[model samples]
Target: MPTPSVRRSRPAAVRDRRAAASRPARREPLSTKQVIGLILGGIAFLLPLVLDVPDLDDMGERMLAIFLLAIVLWVTEAIPLVATAVLVIGLEVLLVSNQALLPVPEDATAYSTFLGALANPVIILFLGGFLIADGAAKYHLDKNLAAVLIKPFTGSARTTVLGLMVITALLSMFMSNTATTATMFAVIIPILGALPSGKPRTGLALSIPVAANVGGIGTPVGTPPNAIALGALAERGYHISFASWMVMAVPLMLVILIGAWLLLIALFIPNGLGIELDMKASWATDRKAVTFYVIADCVILAWMTESLHGINANVVGFLAVVALLVTKVMGGEDLGRLSWPVLWLVAGGIALGDGVGATGLDAWILSLFNWGAMPALVVVIVMGALGLGMSNVISHSAASNLLIPLAMGLATGIDGLEPVTIAVVLALACSLGMSLPISTPPNAIAYATGEVTTADMTKVGIVVGVIGTVLLVLFMPSIWGALGLL
Candidate 1:
């Protein structure tokens, strides 16, 4: 006795589900949007190759054009991330024929752009550190800490968020952003599952992801983008020490964590969730556990900054994960659990950014923007926006890799501006984790929890992203300028 409307809707719903789950056929059916982008990409590809265009004659111009095309792919979400990496690398190194990109003086190697970027110690350190983070999860240290921290705060959603952020921040200081995120996800799933299935529970469940995003700001290893920024800074001769980074890092993370916690309190629980914490089990922290955590962290820090021979940071980190897991210091399953997607994405980001730099594209793009004449404050704002905006489009590590070099190039061009100071702003902005689910690993991690929709995350991001950026723009001059970077 179903109505005509109900009968029709059922068939259509089933068909839609089938279409969504269908794998890409050997001959993929192109969407209207994809078709349009493909056409545009084709024109762009051919224009430089066939016409021998004057602007294209310069390597810089062509590189900028290609970067813009990558942006196009980013906007449309048409290509896989790795596919963009391949396209960018091939176009920048192999295809480029302009003499300017390959000027014979000083730097001359056939596969310079391609091979040179990979040879960078900073990139190596980043990859190595990520591998270490994967190893950390193989031991259950991350989960133990997460449980120890949040178990006491289960009474309210705000507490859960604050607890998660604090723990994640601490773990990230030693682990990769991706690994930190995965570990945190495992911890939260249990608590969220325990919540009463309703609107209040839903809001609280969403808060844990927000905590993770905020938590990522606390340390260098907390996220890959920060690691890339720091690694690149070291390689570029900035000499930013571990102690120096913490001064800015601690305050930045605290500001976001506390602010978000307050916001959650206001929005989700006016009177509070009225929940209780398990004090006997959670409050009982073993000093031995703390010692292990501290020792593990210091070792990673040494590996990151100090030369330990041919052993890379990733190797050291993974070994630490193994030590912890095998020794039963942390639970075994946690170390084995890691996110492969993030690891590959970061690698692709490294390739993409290196390709851009290798082409001298960043230098040329800076020329086109013409921001050298602007005031110091104006320059900072523009650069922050550029970094944050670009980060929104792709991964944060890629943004840092691109912007760090751009900042270096533009620093001298602008009057009396310290390059590292500007670079720090860009670096910090790289992991701001606001604006979109795609913005950062932490944001993406939070988005994937299903407690928060894209719209909800976006709303939170718009407000917090603005606040976070302003904090950097305002804080950097005082902090870095005091230290004389400005």
Candidate 2:
């Protein structure tokens, strides 16, 4: 008798998943940097016990201490972001709610005051975004979308470059800019590689990073910084809906992209190279993909028509997540695929926002600035400049985490300035960094292609960055004012 056929083993990804789930959770020992973070955190926690700020209540001082510790850990990332988030919860409960350290008031519950941030509406909004983005990826929707969009600009090098940038921007609005850049990088190289070495090749390569950076400004879920700003403002009762954000940011992005395109043409790339671009379409009527499309479209529509629909953005977001799960567009394993660290990072920021309000730190910090006489436009320019600089050095989300609180504080004394507007501008400005490969993931991705040099990036980056900043400074106040956001 023939031997029975042996069943094939599960794929590596599946095996890894089962192994991960079955293994007991391990507590990894801290590294040297993490130990340093702990030391710093301990000092921050103890300082309030030793010294006090004038006019700050006991609770305020303690909260500020935790805030300081969080700032250090977050900036350094000495520990995992989720670990920092868990630490934030634990510290707040121990310091803020424990009667042994401080009296618990009738209005505050440790469970209620601190843990609420974990379930914040903004977090749910991102949850929805994550699910939708995951579904898009699972179906290769972004790639298909790009293939169709790039067909039009196949003839002219400048238009081809612009078209590529446009597609990159659109994809970045929903997908992570990093993922978008990586995906498009593959498509761009084959087309440009055939051409002789020249400016058009360099120009095409440069457009991906520039466009990816600018594209993220178009939506709340487009980048972590946007979510951070939205979550912080929402905590303060300033609601910036999905539609409102897109209305303000999309126009700004378009103008900036136009300026960037012009700068690219003038500086590096020549026109009319006649590159023949042909991207094959893949999504026509695949059942699973079509289901995903319908669900995603409806969710986005509801989010945009929020005023008419009366459904909260968070609710809409959660609905999308549910729909994805119910349709099996994403599975339990897919949950592992999501960027949980980013979500945790945002949670840390929300907790910090909570701490800011509880400790009266926001008001106290505001007191330090004499912004009563500063023009709102100057405030925009200064804040935008600060954001641009900080983002180049750290994660844009970290930049937003540091800057949004200060922006909120500044908003109080500056007449005609809205906290929401400051939050929006700061988030947008964080995406304007492109001078160095270190500035953003997209820039680093482009640099990795070996097509563009650091000097090449810097020369073009400076011009584009300046153009973006000026456009933002010129347009932000007017747009916000017109929208009655100021």
Highest lDDT: which candidate? 2
Over the stretch 333-443, how does candidate 1's per-residue lDDT look in tens digits?
543454444444444444555545655666666777767668878888877887777877677656665566567667767886776677677777766646677776666
- Each prediction's RMSD over C-alphas, in Å, is 7.9, 4.7
Give the alpha carbon lDDT tens digit for every residue of 66-103 in model 2.
77777677656677656776787777877776432567
The global Cα lDDT (0 to 1) of model 2 is 0.80
Off by over 4 Å in 2: 1-49, 80-82, 98-109
Model 1 clashing-pair count:
13
- Candidate 1's TM-score reads 0.75
Evaluate residue 36 in candidate 2 and report its C-alpha lDDT on the 0 to 100 scale.
87
Evaluated at residue 80, the lDDT of candidate 2 is 61
Ten residues in a row with the worst lDDT in model 1? 100-109
